[model samples]
Target: MREEKGVIIRTLQEDINNLKIEQASTLHQLSSTLSHLSSTLSQVADLQHEQNALRQELRKEQNQRLTIQEEVNRLKSKGCQCDNSSRNSTLLPHDIQTVKEAITFDLQLEMKQQNDSIMSEMSRMEKDVRDVKAKIRATAMTISGLVSSVSDLQTQIYFSAGTIRDVNKQWKTNEIIVFPHVLANVGGGYDASSGVFTVPKSGVYVLTCFLSTHSSSMYAKLILNGNPVVGITAVTNDVSDVDTGGNAMVSRFQQDDRIWIQFYIGHFLWTMSDASVSTFSGFLL
Candidate 1:
């Protein structure tokens, strides 16, 4: 591994050195080219100056008793550097300067376009990041709400029970005991009119049932999901007449499971307005 790392480092250093050498060579070449261009422009300007001087001399000689063709010959024989025949010689310098200006302008425009593209790309990426963060925040809030709701459901409980007030149903089979005096129905799981308690959520629940007999004996079964799960018997033969019995048990229930008290064999129970006459209850563990 160390040998590999040394080789990689050596390779990178060599590459960097080569790149620097190439860059320096390119800069030298560019400098030489610019110097040559400047020299040529200067020489062209000198030639134009000489040409103006020759024109001035020709004009003066024309006024001095000489034929125009002879004056041209004299001007040519004087070794004056003037070529009126070709216009390209004068225009070439301006063209070269124009080309240089155009190249500079194009380079500047290209650079500006590249910079704008980079800025636009950066802005788009920033917007995408912001949108992602917003979505994450919203998702986090939804998850938190769901967790809170689940916590509440996990810890919830319910209970209820009662007996009818002074009303006497003498004797019958399958008689559902209507607990009329509602004492504690915390979660509204029990319906007083139906004489039944429904499971609010599916879980293990503790249920209790009780009844009081007056002037008679009472027998009932705690009915759960249409089946008897527990039984209660209370007998009162004396005039004092307040025999009470109850049972409690734990059972698993599903959603909307039903429970109630059902009297069997015409057994009787009495409900009074006073507290503790008879009561039933249930709660989650």
Candidate 2:
């Protein structure tokens, strides 16, 4: 009976040790997960802070650009008016002839000399105005570019997916794909329902689109102003392993140009895992 009790105690002690070991291991895993979560949260906060700073900077630049543009228009309207006013300041002639003819001649000569001096001064002033107008034009072009860049920064848009959940679908050849879910749109240029991004101003842009395939061979292209700027093609045959292809381009766009994607004939885009991880992204370059 004593040996039996000893064996029972030893078994109980071993079970307690095993439980302790499992508890420690579980605690370690929880600690690691918490640490990783904290790091991810910190990174998210930093990204938010950086985005806010960029917004503020863009706003500041846009305001400054507006002020400069207004000045340019105003200066352009006031151009050459100074020269016209100078020409209109010339005095008329007088009607009198008598013993004061000598005095009249002297007065006429003096007036002519003064008028010549004024004309010379006006010419110099006009030259100065020309120089200023040139400077304003150069400044206007520079500021216009800056305004476009900042406006592009302010007018960003990204698409992730559509609202069509689990709907078996196929995009026909030359048909457009509309992403119903918009992740971000700075300006109202991007239409989520139509999946078209309209260019608000003329400038160069960097565009990227990702298309995922499940089983159908697919070829998609980014269409800008009814022309293909970039294209990608992919084919998937296995269900367990999916395939994805993407197209990117740095293309020049004009104002009011509509940008979207079109699938080629005999190709289709598919949904994988009940979620649309496919994305379309772009920014002004």
Best by lDDT: 1
Candidate 1 has its poorest 10 consecutive residues by lDDT at 77-86
lDDT of 2 at 188: 64
Query: Going through the candidates in order, what is the number of backbone clashes in each?
Result: 2, 0
Question: Which parts of model 2 have CA positions greater than 4 angstroms off?
Answer: 1-167, 239-241, 266-268, 272-275
Expressed as tens digits, the lDDT of each residue in 1-285 for candidate 2 is 224324533654564466556556655655555555565556556555655665565566556556655654454444344335546754422222232355545555655565565556556555655654565565556556555544444443332334324325766878887776666564467788788888766777666676666656678888887888788776776654456677667778888899997778434455545455465656554
Candidates in order have lDDT scores of 0.64, 0.60
Q: Model 1 segments beyond 4 Å from truth?
A: 1-87, 91-134, 137-159, 164-174, 184-189, 198-205, 213-219, 233-243, 250-256, 265-273, 283-285
Cα RMSDs, all models: 29.6, 27.8
TM-score of each candidate structure, all chains considered together: 0.47, 0.44
Number of backbone clashes in candidate 1? 2
Highest TM-score against the true fold, candidate: 1
